[model samples]
Target: MSTHLLSRHSHRPRASLSLLTRGAAITPAITLERGRAHEACGPARRSFALWLAASTQGPVLWITPQWQPVTLNPDGMMDFADPARFLFVAAPRREDQLWAIEEALRSGAAPLVVADLEEPPAMTPVRRLHLAAEQGGSLGVAPLALLLTPGSGGAAGIESRWHMSPAHQGRQRIWQLDRLRARTQPPACWRLQQKAPRSGLQLCPAPQADLPSEGPHLRATQQ
Candidate 1:
């Protein structure tokens, strides 16, 4: 093929949505490509989702199962984003939850769409979400779809997968964040903490020995 044709076929650089505060000394800003679906698992998955919501501007569309026993506490969400900024979509069934997520992504109205899922969905639905996000991006804003799964997330075809859990030591509030899977990044770990209330978050390397094993808890603290 001619050089011109090759250039036309080459992949273009993609836009990314920042997922965390950029105050970490050695760590670069962790971001997910816009118009893609990502996964967050582990004990603090809800907290991870809240962190993502805090990083973005505009309204957030959060979809969860209506029958789920526990719901997001407004007081708990205050540390991240304003609870009033979130528009909740409570789906009555599993399939409805996925459908709501798909529609929200396709609409491109909200910059972030979060699905608090008990478990991860299959590859086919994930692909559909990717397509919907791409279409939404073309129409207006490029929405980022996040799946909050319980335990060790095993969602297939996701742009990336992250696991976070509490690593508190006495009075200090800390969490261990692991980039378990990514297409372009290798596995890595970090210790995330805030110096004070309403202060910027800090990230530092976590010692291998300090990393905690996956716990059975699904609920995350408001911190």
Candidate 2:
């Protein structure tokens, strides 16, 4: 028999085109899984920042825009003991009030500033606050502002944003903490009660397994 010329392409197995396409489809899912895993591993940036501000034993400025004639007694003061220092400012008007608050924040006299106003602040104002905090070497605790409204308008400088809400009461006058916004971590809810026998308010623990049962009872009314 006459020998046929061997074809160069005959011997090699065909490459799997389907395998390449399948790997391409799997890449995005793998990336998403890794992202979720990272989020689960760390404490939310906002919550951690709030905790730091609350724990700081320095001067703090509290701005209450909605309620007038607000006062903080020694006991009420102790409730926010983490931010050990404070200055209470009540502003009724938006324009005038924000300006005054901004001035105080820029002063750097206080390490923390809290604004409880009716409307969420604009992005520019929030950015200013961030810059002020950075320059002053302080933290700002804006529980109300961050909660009730859209903080989208605020400046891009905010390190973290948190949404905190009041939880139910326990045996004493303990309040629960609900977190609505925590960028890097999953949302968390917990209870924090204080014992203030000397200050007149009592501390009570929630009826949860992790919480302890031995604390003074908080009176129904604020002293």
Query: Best-fitting candidate, measured by TM-score?
Result: 1
What are the RMSDs of all candidates, in order? 4.5, 18.3
lDDT of 2 by residue, 42-160 (tens): 11222222333344446556665544433434443334343245565667677766675566656656544555455555667766654544444333332112212323222232333
Clashing pairs in 2: 54-82, 54-83, 60-85, 123-153, 123-154, 123-155
Q: Estimate TM-scores for all models.
A: 0.85, 0.48
Candidate 1: give the clashing pairs.
Answer: none
* Deviating ranges (above 4 Å) for candidate 1: 1-10, 22-25, 205-223
Error of 2 at 52 (Å): 7.2
Q: Give the per-residue lDDT digits (tens) of candidate 1, residues 121-219.
A: 999999999999998899666999999998899999998999988776644557788889988778877787755644546764453233353222233
lDDT of 1: 0.80
Q: All models: lDDT?
A: 0.80, 0.37
CA lDDT, candidate 2, residue 14: 15
